[model samples]
Target: MDSKIVLITGGSSGIGKAIGIYLTKKGFTVYGTTRNLKKYPDFTEFQLLEMDVREPQSVNRAIDVLLEKENRLDVLVNNAGVGITGPLEETPNKEILNAFDINFIGPLNVIKSVLPQMRRQGSGLIINITSIAGYMGLPYRGIYSATKGALELITESLRMEIKDFGITCTCLAPGDFATNIAAGRYHAPVNNDSPYKESYGKTLNTIDQDVDKGGDPEEVAKKVLQIINTKNPKVHYKVGALLQKFSIVLKKVLPDTWYEQLLLNHSKK
Candidate 1:
């Protein structure tokens, strides 16, 4: 069998970087893409490509170059994303659009760019790195959650649509992982003595505390490897600490009033 070729977006850092390293060690040819390649440099086991997923032209051109060089693509991992933190009302419209572009539309661009090749091959995998926030809403992160929700829906529809083409679409919804996501560039609406300022302050503090308790990104990358190697991959893969599991289960089983209260209590802290 030929070595599996994998393309990972946002592979310069975080879970994407870990996944690239893990897959390379497993003898797969990994191609990692990012806007900035200097940070990652060149690696013997993997090739780094520059791509801006938000731009359709950039996405298409990158995919073209990958295909021209490798002649085939076996797996694509859409992991590039940005987080916007603030109350819904306090988030500017452009910031919300940027979040959607990076988190949702970006993946769509990559997927569309790669689908024809995967279909021609008659077998391939596309893994979308969603978040626990994709499944459940969090305080002061409505915009981010909305983007994930959009991805969740896209993954579901793609899974159903591409099965006949021997393509698999899996959604990897992880809980809080120890990553630079929070520290990454963020744009919050100017607070002009907003009424929600107090609530937003408390919510931000809670986010900081939770991130301190988040899981390791490398561990999450291991899970991605397992999913790729599995004979029958599931559509949804959830990973996190016990609290994350509980939160997901509670959101599903608890009454609306109860869940709302739970969210309120957490936000206040």
Candidate 2:
């Protein structure tokens, strides 16, 4: 059998890095792409490339480089993303655009670039790292949830479209992995004279507390590996503790009004 070749975006750190390491250890050739090469050095089993998912040219160039080195590509993991947190009214236009670009458009760019190769090979996998926010709306994460929701829809459509081509698409929806995502949350510009100054501080504090309780990134990575090896990968795989499992069930069982009220109540506390 030919060795598996996997390409991962945003693999410099967090869940992406953990996935790269795990796959490499499992004997797959791992190619990792990141915008910050200086921050992430090359690893033993993984080759690092400079690529920004937000830029089509960068994504295409990186794909060309990989194709030139290896004639066949087996897997593409679209893990590059960003988060924006603030009241919708306070969030800037640029921040919202960036979140959508990185979270939703970025994956589409990668899929467009790599789909031809996978189609030719007649077998491959595309893993999308989505959040539970994709399914359940959360307070102060309107923009982020919107982006993930878009991804979820895309993943569903692609799964049916690509099945005929012998390619599989899996959307891995993790609840809250303990990752740097929280630290990297985008903050809206504040004016000292602004009326929302006091509320902004409280919002930031709430974000900090939520992030501190996020699940372990390594555990999420393990789930990614399992999905890759599973005979029948699920359209959506939820990872985390009981709370996360409950949330997913509730989203399906409860009415929208009740769900919204529950989220609003949690946010206030």
Per-model TM-score on C-alpha atoms: 0.94, 0.92
RMSD (Å) of each candidate, 1 decimal = 1.7, 1.9
lDDT of 1 by residue, 1-269 (tens): 88999999998887888889989888899998988666665554478888999998999999999999988999999999997898777677888899999999999999999999999999999999998888767778888888998898899899999999999999898888777777884746437698887878878877877777788887778888899899889988888887877788899899988998998898787
**Candidate 2 Cα errors over 4 Å, as ranges:** 41-45, 189-200
User: Over all chains combined, what TM-score does candidate 2 have?
Assistant: 0.92
The backbone clash count of each candidate, in order, is 0, 1
Which lDDT tens digits does candidate 2 get at residues 1-269?
Answer: 76788999988888888888888888888999989778765455489888999999999999999999998898898998898877688788888999999999999999999999999999999999888888866767888889998999899999999999999998988876678886677876555776766665565666677777887777877888888889879898878777867887897889999988887766656
* Clash pairs detected, candidate 2: 178-215
